[model samples]
Target: MPRYLFLKHYRTGQTPHPNAADRWTPQEISDHMAFMDAMIEDLKANGQFVGAEALSPRGTFVRYGGEGKPPVTDGPFAETKDLIAGWMAVDVESEEEAYAKAAYLSSAPGYGGRPLYEWIEVRPFLSEADTPDLG
Candidate 1:
């Protein structure tokens, strides 16, 4: 089975549901979390769940500068254009299955108990199966 990653981003432009989480009521937030938990449980029951995580917006870019001349650091890029909120990894049989799962995840509720319908990026994990025969 191929593994895929579903990435949720903090995009502002062209968002179908633009309810900021900070503005959501406590119950709405809890309901959203509960929905996510249920989705995970369903995926697990189907043997498709691999792992998931919610990322801290505060993050830094680090680079190995020279041999050992102290690592170079860039930013705690909370305001970057491509900010990722979270991700869920799934091992499934096909790309379509991955897409379906991502679509379901995007249906997670937002404020007013309406579906967020936010975009979920689906990317496949490459493996030996993707490599061509060089012989």
Candidate 2:
């Protein structure tokens, strides 16, 4: 099976609803957890689920030009224009299957009575065939 990445992208500074920030009470968190539990069960039943996780927003990116060239960068790169919020990797039989899974995931619930303006980007992972089978 081929591995595909389902990446979630969203705008960083937009509130979904006027009172969205205020809606993050304990009840809202519980409801979100329940929804996630159901989604996990659904994914497992379909046999398309490999693994998933949530990531912290904080990150450090390093960029290097050449050997001993001294990498330059700092925490929290200010380039959120094309930043990826989070992602999930799933193993599927084909591109069609990958797309189907991504579509299903995008339909999952989110805060503010709808998804967080997020979009899923499905990309196939590079395989050994892409290069030479080192074996």
Candidate 3:
């Protein structure tokens, strides 16, 4: 099974619901958690679930370009438009399988009704055989 990463991308300041700015009530969070639980169960039953996680908005980004170049740049960059919301990694048999998984994930219920502003980017993982291992 090949491993693939499902990345969630969204613009900053996009709320899940019109009233989301008010903060999640306990019931709202509970409902979302229940939906996630169901989704996880379905994934496990299908053997398509490897692992998943949500990431924080803050990140440290480093860029390198130059002779004898030391890495430059630091966290808290000004660009919020291109920030990643989160990611999930899964192992599947083929590209078709990967696509199906991503489609299912995108349809999963979230904060409010649905996350219209969110998008999923599926990418296959690189295997050790595909590159020379330094270690």
Task: Give the distance in Å from residue 106's predicted Cα in candidate 2 to where it truly belongs.
Answer: 1.3
Report the CA-based lDDT of candidate 1 relative to the real structure.
0.84
What's the ranking of the predictions by lDDT, best on top? 1, 3, 2
Q: Which stretches of candidate 1 lie over 4 Å from their true place?
A: 12-17, 66-70, 78-80, 132-135
Residue 95: error of model 2 in Å? 1.3
Going through the candidates in the order shown, the clash numbers are 0, 0, 0
Give Cα-based local distance difference scores for all models.
Answer: 0.84, 0.65, 0.68
lDDT tens digits, residues 10-129, model 2?
333443333232356666556655765676677678776777776554555788858878776665563543456567787778899888878777665456556533457888889887
Per-model TM-score, in order, reads 0.84, 0.68, 0.66
**What are the per-residue Cα lDDT tens digits for candidate 3 across 42-131?**
878888777877666566677885779877766457355455766778778998988887887766554554543345789999987789
Residues 3-100 of candidate 1: C-alpha lDDT, one tens digit per residue? 99999887646542376676789999899999999999999999989999987766767789999598787754534436788999999999998998
Error of 2 at 64 (Å): 2.5
Worst 10 residues of 1 by lDDT: 73-82
| lDDT score of residue 47 within candidate 3 | 84
- TM value for model 2: 0.68
| Pairs in steric clash, model 1 | none
